[model samples]
Target: MEKLELTPPPAILFALEPLRAMADYVASLAPASQPLPQGDGHPVIVFPGLGVSGYATEGLRERLKELNYEVHDWEQGVNQWPDTEFDGFLDLLSEQLKRIHSQNGRPISLIGWSLGGVYARELAKTHPKLVRQAITLATPFADQPNSTHAGWLFTLLNGGVSPMDEALLRRLSIDPAVPCTSVYSPSDGVVGWAGCVGTESEYHRNIEVDNVSHWGMLHNPEVLRVVARLLAEHRRGTFRTLLDTCVTKLL
Candidate 1:
């Protein structure tokens, strides 16, 4: 196993992020890419990363939709620090999840990216009954803020953060009661990959997709296929080996 890196990624890997992001786009459009393990029409909510909006997740959401899930983006505007409307966002999120679950009579699935993954875990803690499972993409919820290269940008956007922020960081590391998955890449260019990994158990699994960059996690086709497989199962599974047996072998 590679070292569980505590510091930000090296400059070379960080520098490759934008280029890998571009290649992800090309790969998504290539005829070779295909959806595996089709979804079961469960409702899913996708949360965006920091400094981005739902638009950034359009491709990912579209892929989920193609897999037969009822997918919806957060629609929470740009993900800004000092989010003044977060309480309101949570309120609306609760309404949507409850409504979807009531209508469909199935627990909703959550797919969150980066900072948004924090929201998903906390939300599931409070409403585990409404959530079937959760999947986090490049989310460093278990790490200190400074472990990420983008920490400074968060501080700059919010002026300064308080020491109490560590309390939330600890809370983020707590696994949700329902099934959960944390997808990580060793060469992640933004957040430290180690912190993105949650403690693994029967209901919670950490998976490694080595080719992904933090910036490329959203639209990378393999990531989509992984999510599709988990959602199709509609329950917890031996997903740690899913990439090796399902994703790689299919390719």
Candidate 2:
């Protein structure tokens, strides 16, 4: 993996979140396929970005529900990271995964945004059998620890306890055992885009979107469309079709 320079000047673009939100709202008005792509109603849990509450992902949760998937919120309120201790947070997530798996009698999919994406990837690594797939939005797992635009804020919020230590960063760089899709944008102003790239493999793929804001990823219509398509493919076991369709759409 290539090292990314975390220059603060470019990161100031994150302040344009309001503009991105407006654009996302307009994009959402465009018509997509009716009924979208139906899923098998398998359970899905969405995790919010750092310092954000589950409500931040309500739009995505609703969209997933429209696809007939059993979507769920993290229900852990704001993601305060080390406040709950990393191990405790993982335990909570693990418990939720187990409960959902037991109830649905099948593995669950995880869709995480930003820091939440980190958690999703780690969870899948720890318990691949419990996860059907893992999808991340603009997550910076490939770069060295602490090399993020939000490092300052993250440090202040966590009381100087960095979540991305050397060991954890090394673990995050490896591909998870389950099917994984990383949805990212070069225009993202929060995390370095290079760090968001997933190592391509039989089960790992990266989808790059154009002109998408880091914060707008959860509500970006194009991103949502690809996510819905990926979920549908997973449900239907259409890997070849997915590859062809993604190539066409992305081109």
Candidate 3:
């Protein structure tokens, strides 16, 4: 019998300077995780990763709601679903965000997983006024043209033929002014570790965790803690408590 080989997600090999910068930024922010008056009843739109369905993340969504966040799912089916084109993907996101604003009179927050993170960033950029903040889990901004193996396969699986080049990276990289948080692990089972790092810039924080696979991270308690912290800080204007917790854990 032939044994199957599991190719680990691409690792991030480099000095820790950039990661330290990200960590410091997160720590510097004040800690406050409370519901915002703006969010009143506005729903949070969640974008799941490739081949991931809402059912799989129901627990997480419910958990957030329990924390007082109104959670909404795209329900676009898993990565295996055939008709998932990029343009159509964007259209759906635009409509959903608009709908949330219309129904709740407030901007919505986006929590994107894997490839879905890319969409979340784009939506925030296009509708900055309507998107309060974006949380990307294990997403990347690879040199578009030289993106890692998984990115290429992802493109093939989804529709679209734009080469991963500097242009694409520049276009997709979230603006510095937009509040965005990227949660990633060096040991992810898919996507290169480098892709997870947020470029040295303002209002962008990258968090690196240990022992989380690309898929497993969606449910990792630590990751959830980080997400809850980020979202709460954004809506409530306090982040020091959580930052202190993370600092204590690191120490």
Candidate 4:
């Protein structure tokens, strides 16, 4: 097993090369068929990670739609730098959740990738009634320090937002009460592997995949399978994993 690195390589190209390979590998493992259900279903909002473009996630959204999920892309354009802008993102998220609740007449399920996962968790925190289930792929707790080359660079550039302050972390980290699942990999070429762990408790789940890079999990077939299964389980009113005892059925 490759050890996760907190320090990013100096070369930008080198750091990103592994990500490209991972993306290609994930693309190769695409499932042959993703069947959609035949009727109206709960709304599912898909949030892609930071710096990711719409093109990167089009396939994933299509797959969700195939599975009959009413998928909505978090159309905030490219997720370049939300931390710096802080653009009332929480407010926008609140509005979106309210709209989804009103439109669907129920809570919405969220599948957020990377930083988008942070947004998804915040939604659950602010409007728990509007979120049925929240799943995050490679999204770190706000309190944890990120380990990407860019993450370090941004921290250096921004003076100091250390990822290891206990008080600060407690303030920023997501609570496990929102039925959250975090998917991560030890071999992730991006983000500190340790930062991927969910809050220590029964309500949160931390799924570790082997050898998959951070970017790769976005489109990895097995990851998609787990996501689809979880969504289906939620639909059947049996969403809790065996690992978590809290079961709330809403149909």
My TM-score estimates for the predictions, one after another, are 0.88, 0.89, 0.71, 0.76
lDDT per residue as tens, model 2, 4-91: 5643326456677568767877777778744466888889999999889998999899989988999999888987675665777788
Question: How good is model 2 by TM-score?
Answer: 0.89
The deviation in Å at residue 51 for candidate 1 is 0.6
Q: How many clashes in candidate 2?
A: 0
Candidate 1, residues 43-83: lDDT per residue as tens digits? 89998998899998998898888888998887667776435
Question: In model 4, how large is the Cα lDDT of residue 188?
Answer: 61
Cα lDDT of model 2 overall?
0.79
Runs in model 2 with CA error above 4 Å?
A: 1-12, 33-35, 235-245, 249-251
| Every candidate's lDDT | 0.78, 0.79, 0.64, 0.65
Best by TM-score: 2
**Could you tell which candidate, 1 or 4, scores higher by TM-score?**
1
The list of candidate 1 runs beyond 4 A from truth reads 1-5, 33-35, 82-92, 162-164, 236-251
Q: What is the C-alpha RMSD of each candidate to the true structure, in Å?
A: 3.0, 2.6, 9.9, 5.6
Q: What is the lDDT of residue 138 in candidate 2?
A: 86
lDDT of 4 by residue, 1-251 (tens): 23334443235434664666567465646554654233246788888876675667787788788778888888677765455434376786677778877987977888887777877877777777678878888776642454454476446544566434576466446563566778776666656556667554545667776656667776776667667656665442233453343222211
Worst ten in a row by lDDT for model 1: 234-243
Ranking by TM-score: 2, 1, 4, 3
